[model samples]
Target: MEHSRIAVAGASGLIGAALVRSLAADGHEVVRLVRREPRTPDEVRWDPERKYVDPAGLAGCDAVVNLAGANVGSRRWTDAYKARIRDSRVLGTTALAEAVASLDRPPRVFVNGSAMGIYGETGDRAVDEDAPPGEGFLPELCVEWEGAAAPARAAGVRTVFTRTGLVVSREGGAWGRLFPLFKAGLGGRMGDGRQYWSFVSLHDEVAAIRHLIDTDGLSGPFNITAPHPLTNAEITAAMGRVLHRPTLFTVPAPVLRAVLGEMAGDVLGSQRVLPMRLLESGFTFAFPEIEEAIRAAK
Candidate 1:
């Protein structure tokens, strides 16, 4: 893509914030979809719940990326909070899909955010885009979340869903919380540390989205993960080595369940996903190893 105009939802988030900066630095015209009243010409007001977005703001954009959603690990998952997590993704996606569909000239591509959680509890299996979704709240929610973008797909727009992995970054997300703990020598593996954690650096995550936008003749779900997936224990060891801390502590699964409620299932579950489709499409990762990603995050 040659410095094309791009519209982004969820511009305030960790991935969204970095993606916006990366796109702007590369000279792409960036427009942010905000929940608040428009603060500038580049910001557009939108209400996902109300299914309203000023289509004029998105007109003639080369691509529209939707990353709007609630943070899964932000708090203990109460029933209401779980509903918010689901609504935040599905409703926001539906709203954006409908808005883009209504445009006379929709974006050439729609890159919507997804997660590896869709293939719930893959154990030690290294799955990719072709794997079927496993059973669980997260899996079912992911199916619905991706399906929410039907309006855009139905409108003949080239739509893609990025099944992103655990983004390793110090700014925010799950790894952000782990950085401080590891720096203070309090970090350790959760549960027995056997579960796999598919991860990608923040740089790679942003780069993959741009690749999806630029690459043509590609649609459907793509795993935005590193080629190699490591178990939690391995990641703990890497963190200890990178931060010069001891990885001697362990958090039992029972304690995690008691504290995180239903969300503990995700924390202890395994999904050894790989970026098979992404690599085949010619997207390269700058930090494919755990150590390199940890060092970059630091």
Candidate 2:
């Protein structure tokens, strides 16, 4: 694929930063959309809460990738925090979608970020992108979150909703917390440890986004998880194997709920997701197995 200029929201985030680096390394010009004042030539300012972005600033980008949102598990999911989670996603996505649509020369594609929680708990059932949404606040949130991108899709941009799985990275996300705990022999399975955790290496996550940007005839939702989904016990074992730590401890579901509150359900929930669409589109994962992903994160 030929290199093209791209506008990226949440460019400072874990996946976003990696993408910016990857795109730059591949010789693509990246314009970062920041909330603060722009300090560089490649930065643009936007206020998602107000649905504001300078159309002229994003006028000629080849693609717009919206990865901005409050981290769902960043805090206790209190009533106000829950509102923050929903609003952050809907507002940011809507702002970007409208901005992209309003541009005289809109980008060819819009890669909108979403989550696999859209499937809720799949409990031993292997699910793909075609699976109907499951029940939960997350499923509903993801639906509306993805829906906020309608403007871009309506403007004829090939919009792709990326339903990401547990990202295995030391930088942050699920692995950030897990790595330290496992290094100190403190890592263990949550609940009964049977809940399947569909995951992808951070490397693959960024690569998959880049793939979507250039791949033609690909629109709508694509699952961005490893082909093999590991249960919580399997993940714990993999971590112990990679870190050479003991994996004898197990945290009860009740304990998790008491500590993490509503967020515990997500930790203990099963989401055996598969990147069926991405594989069908000829994209290959660099780390598709638990051990491979864990070792790579090491």
Worst 10 residues of 1 by lDDT: 44-53
lDDT tens digits by residue: candidate 2, 203-232 = 999999999999989999999999999899
Q: CA lDDT of 100 in candidate 1?
A: 92
Segments of candidate 2 deviating more than 4 angstroms: none
Candidate 1 lDDT, 1-298, residue by residue in tens = 7889899999999999999999999999999999999989999888886777888999989899999898999999888998999988999899889989999989999999999999999998889899999998889999999999999999999999999999999999999989999999999999999999999999999999998999889999999998999999999999999999998889999999998899898889988999999999998899999999999999
| TM-scores of the models, in the order given | 0.98, 0.98
Cα lDDT listed for each candidate: 0.93, 0.92
Residue 165 in model 1: lDDT:
95
Q: What's the count of clashing pairs in each model shown?
A: 0, 0
RMSD of each: 0.8, 0.8
**Lowest-lDDT window of 10 residues in candidate 2?**
48-57
Q: Which predicted model would earn the best lDDT?
A: 1
